[model samples]
Target chain A: MRPRVALNIKSVDYEFLQEQFGSKSELLLKSNPVHKKIPVLLHNGKPICESSIIVEYIDEVWSSSPSILPSDPHNRALARFWAAYLDEKVPLFWVITAASEEEKNAAVDQLKEVAVEMEGAYGETSRGGDFFGGDKIGVVDIAFGSMLGSARAIQVRVGVKLLDEEKTPGLVKWAEKFSADPAVKDVLPETEKLVEFAKLLSAKFKAAAASDPLRR
Target chain B: MRPRVALNIKSVDYEFLQEQFGSKSELLLKSNPVHKKIPVLLHNGKPICESSIIVEYIDEVWSSSPSILPSDPHNRALARFWAAYLDEKVPLFWVITAASEEEKNAAVDQLKEVAVEMEGAYGETSRGGDFFGGDKIGVVDIAFGSMLGSARAIQVRVGVKLLDEEKTPGLVKWAEKFSADPAVKDVLPETEKLVEFAKLLSAKFKAAAASDPLRR
Candidate 1:
């Protein structure tokens, strides 16, 4: 999704290849033998795996209008830092449908803690109003922007709000602008379909947790 | 360690703040509250967390000579890919001290598989005759170089060579050059001390695996 938003922002034309989890294409397997995961941007026969790396590749190749990553090295590091934090911390919110309510509540609290840290990370350094890398949608914005789409679906599915307006007003505002961005909205999956997909995923997660022998 | 090597390669003098795992300093905790891990480069009081990010920061700040990352965007992406691969795959080798011989053998096999892929990655792309990212000890070299140091110690303790010369001659050669590099050797801990450390770590791993309720 980030790669798509980046491409769209740069107005770079490319084909989108949707890959199913169980039936991944031979191209994906061949292009990304290491991970064999999706968002493998195949450009001129070369495949770039990993979402963040792919986005960087796109920004480098296009190198035209909107830059995803900042030009300054320190700012680039800080953007990478927050992007990495989002990757590590956002997944903890996936246990919203853990087998027990206590576990679910814990996941919510963890999400809240991560949100607060993200709020601090965005302090006084924002370029654009509300975006992490400031006014423009930089790498960190795309990183969290991609997650916010799914987070909205999860919110609808679980009937629990992870990004509370009162607690994380900045993130809330950023999400609104991010979702409203023409390029971002162009690639976002419909909320209703996402809710349905989330239901299926949450069921599998609950089943896995219930059957986990190590779970005490 | 990669950060240290990058700094050394660039001939940038800086202070080393050793961080204890069990009791991290408040500065570390404050500087990197997200992960609270070390190798946090605080240049001009701004914190750069994550070793890779720190290395990139060093390269950008002291962009005078011996750049760790490739200048080409595509090559840069590839270097980042291999570095990320090392981070993900090398840690699996640490599980070699599993409770059972079967599990230990499985871990060894996993390491061998990772080594073969790494061999292919370094095939004709080497610059420095025996280094990844060519002969210059780039980011990929530092990434794996840091791992190879501990791996040698583990080899001494376990008496099992994970980097079989026949299976991974490229990596074997690369490891030798990496260990011999002045920048790398300057920061590496003593092999004998690392061996003792490996022994203690293996014992703890075996004990934990033995008590693992999930293990059949």
Candidate 2:
């Protein structure tokens, strides 16, 4: 999604190929045999794996936009740090949606703790912009915004408010502004569909939890 | 260590402060409060966490020397992929080193299998430069080379060979060339010191394993 937002922002023409998980394509396997993961951008017959790396690659190959990363070295490092940090932190949100009943409370508490920490950090760095990367949507905004977008639907499905307006005002406001942006809206998955997927994941997780004797 | 290598290769002079793990400084915590981990590059007072990001930041900030990363986007992506892959796969070496005798055989076999796969990949892309990025000690070489340097010491301490010459000839040869390189050797920890560290880790792991009912 970060790559999509980046390409759209830069107005770079590209073909979007959806990967089917149940039966991943031979091409995907061949192209990114190292990880065999999706979001592999095939540019000029060369495949780039990893979403953050792909975003960087896109920024390098098509140097026309206001730059997905900032021009300054320190700011660029900050952007990359937050983006990578977001990737590490996003799994906690999923833990909330996927945890069994016994674990759900703990998971929600942990997620909220993470949210509070992020709020503190985000508040300290806020430039009064509509995005994490300032007035425009940059790499950090794209990465964190996409995860927060998914977290929104997960919050709804789990009926646990991890991103409360009071507790995480900075993140909540950023999420709202990110979701409302035209380019972001164009690439975001439908909220209803996301909720449905969350439900399916929750069911699978519960089933697995039930079958485990230690949990039982 | 990879960041250190990158900076050293470019002859960038700076201070290297060893962080005390027993009681980390408030400044270290403030510099990279998010991860609170080092190999954090403090350039002009701004902190950059994560080794690969720091390497890129260093390369971008000081553009005098030959670039650590390739200019071509595809090649750059490949470098990023392999560097990331090495990060993910390096833990397997420690697993092999620290596994209890009962698990040691399995761990060694698994590590060997990884070696075989990497050998195949390396053989296909060999450019006779004794490095992953070819001709010069590029980013991927710095990363994997650092790990291999440690692996060599681990191999000596564990009395178990994971990087056998016959099975992983390309990697073995690359490792030899990398360790001998003046820039890389200048920064690598003393082999004897690394062996002592490996002994400490192996003892800790064995102690933990012995107490675990699952392992028993």
Candidate 3:
């Protein structure tokens, strides 16, 4: 979703491959032998794995309008920092489905704390605008925006509000604006479908955790 | 160490502050409010946290001879990919200190396979040269090179060879070459000192693991 949104924002036409989860593909294994994960961008014949790296690679190669990353070095570093911070909280999106009550409570608290910081970041970077990039979606926007779908799914599945008006009013608005954006509207998965997928994944994780506690 | 080595390679003279481990100061807390960890590069007045991000920031800000990262887009992507890969394996460095025997064996096996892939990566990136940046220590070199001190300490403390001549001949040679490079020799810690630190860390981690299983 990150690379796709990045490609869309860059106006680069590309095919999307819905890789079958739990089964490795020859092409994927060949392209990204290290991680063997999705969000692999095959440009010309070379593969660029990892979503954030692929986004930066796309920005460099396309060199089109609406540059995904900022031009200033300090801005780029802040963007990278926020992107890393958001990506690090990815498990926070799933811990609701995979954690114990104690862990779930802890994750929720941490996520709320993350939301407070991110709200300030969005406020500062937006400069009273609608997005983290002040106007169009930039790296920091795409970074957390890509996870908004999963976050919504988790919110529904867990019957918990991770981002609400009181906690993250700006983020709630940002999420709505981000999902409605023309470039990435089709890219973000529907919340209901993701909810069902989350249900299945939670079950799968529960089974895996039966034997391997670390799966949680 | 990554940013320091890159700064040295870029010929950017700077003061070094030895941050006391365990107890983060107010400056660190103010600079990097997110992680509040070490390796925070204070440039002018702003702070850049995370070693890898700091290295790229230095490369972008300094922009002199001996480029830390490559110029080409694909090559730059490859460098970032390898850097991310090596950083992801950071846990493989500490698992030996706080892991079960079976888990440690699994980590060892995984590290060996990582060595195989990294050897191929080094061979391709170096192109018959000494460092991953071909002639000088670039991003990839600094990425893994900075970890050589701990790896050597682990090799001695754990009695397990990670990058041996039989499995990774090029890497063994590259390790020596990277360590001997004047730009980063002082930045890399002494193995004996690191070995002692590793022992103390292992003991501390064991104490933590006694209460929390995830400490390992």
Candidate 4:
């Protein structure tokens, strides 16, 4: 059996709360008062913040069934490399969506650079198999796959499309394969729900930025 | 025999590199071309960039000796929490050292807040243990312990100490115990060397900031 770990998972859903601040979850606030962010997994009442680190903890705790990381060290490191890259780079998508026209264009250019790096990292010729590490889905897939919902929404909101089969053919295939996986598919929010949430969040950020001129 | 996973380790004497930039080794550049930073580990020619991630990879690959992480899930998560906390919070020291008088005072205030939080997290009153977990050294120690070298240097450079025994008795005792460990002590850099290097880096950053008006 998986260890009895308490996970205070949060999202931009409001049925559980009054408003969708995305950071209003009481459990999250108690655990990680410093960052006050979501996806804080508390094991034995002690909190481990950061989503990627939490996933790593989960993988270590429950080593049976589907292993999130690979057995080989090199392969595992590669998986981790991609995960870190995604965490460090993918936030630009939201920035692009929320930016002014000039800033938005600059962010789009940065996005293309990141996309090109991803393309190079996971090229058709290199990752010729199903997933990022080939054969099975691992942490890299989970890390990048989790962001795809937001990525799609950001693309739609910003009027800039990325991750096309023609443009990023390998990444497109990988995203499709990742979504189809039973385990991954189980946790993903619906695309429509996520898009609506993104729109709301964008409006909120824009409004806040307008009111607080220092934000720009 | 350990598996022949490609490994590149470094003793990053940042102080030494400041005086003699030639001492800034090529491994940092080779391992992380994109970030161009240090504490990178290259596994099978692919770079795992972040220091914490590198430590985890090292522990996973070389599991024979001392286990950097705890076996229990709860303890492991707790270890990871402090490690992430150190990474997120400890950078304030550099900021304080480099800031103007007003900014330095603000950073000092922020540092005090973090110190209180850290004391609460791993203090004698809260954890009631020797190390971050209990009894033995673990990943939290490694993650935070590595910073002790820099912490000591920063304390000397800034002329303000934050890790005194009386103020944070638990953390102080923990740091003392951690520094005494053979594994940690063997790898740590000399305090004098580190202080010298910190001075050089401070000057470099100041010069760069002066030249670049956009630097914040």
Among these predictions, the greatest lDDT belongs to: 3
The TM-scores, one per candidate, come to 0.87, 0.87, 0.94, 0.77
lDDT of 2 by residue, B36-101 (tens): 778788877778888878998988988777789888888888888877777666656666557656
Worst 10 residues of 4 chain B by lDDT: B1-10
Indicate whether candidate 2 or candidate 4 has the larger TM-score: 2
- Pairwise lDDT winner, candidates 2 and 3: 3
Model 3 residue pairs with clashes:
none
Q: Cα RMSD (Å) per model?
A: 3.9, 4.2, 2.1, 6.3
In model 3, the runs with Cα more than 4 Å from the true position are: A206-216, B207-216
Per-candidate DockQ values are 0.48, 0.46, 0.57, 0.32
| lDDT, residue A74, candidate 2 | 82
lDDT of 3 by residue, B101-183 (tens): 87677777777887899999998889878988588789999988877887788788878888888979999999989888889
Cα lDDT of model 3 by residue, A1-216, tens digit: 889898888777888887786688999999988788887999889998899899999999888778988888888888899998887788776766766777677777777888889998998899877889688899998888887887778678767777889979999999999989988799888899888777677777767766752232
Ten residues in sequence with the least summed lDDT for candidate 2 chain B: B207-216
What is the C-alpha lDDT profile of model 4 across A70-120, one tens digit per residue? 788766776777778777665566655465776666666766667667777
After the best TM-score superposition of candidate 1, give how far the Cα of residue A124 lies from its true spot, in angstroms: 3.8
Alpha-carbon RMSD, candidate 3: 2.1
Model 2 C-alpha lDDT per residue in residues A1-216, reported as the tens digit of each score: 888988987888789999863478999999888778888888878788999899888888888867888888888888887787777666565555577565566556666777787677676556777666578888887887777657668667777776877888788888788788877888888878788777767776667655642221
Query: lDDT at B150 for candidate 1?
Result: 66
Candidate 2 yields a Cα-based lDDT of 0.75
Which segments of model 4 are wrong by more than 4 Å? Answer: A1-19, A41-48, A90-94, A97-106, A124-126, A165-167, A185-187, A190-216, B1-28, B41-49, B124-129, B203-216
Model 1: docking quality category: acceptable
